[model samples]
Target: MRHLIPLLFLAACASTQDPPRGPSLPDTCGAGDYSYLVGQPARALERVLIMEELRIIRPQTMVTMDYRAGRINFKISDQDIITDVTCG
Candidate 1:
């Protein structure tokens, strides 16, 4: 039908304007430590107890940083890549 073409185009344009999708970020009370061994716990750990009180904690994701053609690059996925040179 003729109406289908315009509907498809509108849907395609609408999707492009949305922000990146993934797991939403949790609230942080304040800055804390996120290191290992006998010294102190991570900043995230300070807000709540681990393994005993709260069980909803998830591991922090590892990001890969790189440099490509004079630009700094951070890649989260095959489709998710960011490049910046202003801070460099």
Candidate 2:
């Protein structure tokens, strides 16, 4: 009976432990069907912020971040190609 009581207590403590969690992403942003945008001319896209490596100008109706989504964002290449498309 003594051993059983300790075992029950251990089981209860384990049950109260939180479950493991995985990495999470914002609900506002996600990888959508931007495949069609690939290979298309960058100019063909509607008004959106063009993201490149290291050049800056006045902010327009677009912005960039390591992770963000809520609007159309374009990841472009130096050659002016639409490399990736994401939605926030």
Q: Against the true structure, whose TM-score is highest? A: 2
lDDT per residue (tens digit) for residues 1-88 in model 2: 9789999988887766689788655434434544576776677566543443222212243554554355555667667777766553
> How close is each model in CA RMSD to the real structure?
16.1, 11.5
Could you tell me the lDDT of residue 62 within candidate 2?
A: 51
Which candidate's lDDT is highest? 2
lDDT of 1 by residue, 1-88 (tens): 9989999988887755668698733324211222221122323234543332111112354433431232221112232222111110
Q: Go through the candidates in order and give each one's C-alpha lDDT.
A: 0.31, 0.55
For candidate 1, list the clashing residue pairs, or say none: 32-43, 33-42, 33-43, 34-42
lDDT of 2: 0.55
- What TM-score, over all chains together, does every model reach? 0.25, 0.38
**Residue 18, model 1: Cα distance from true site in angstroms:** 5.2
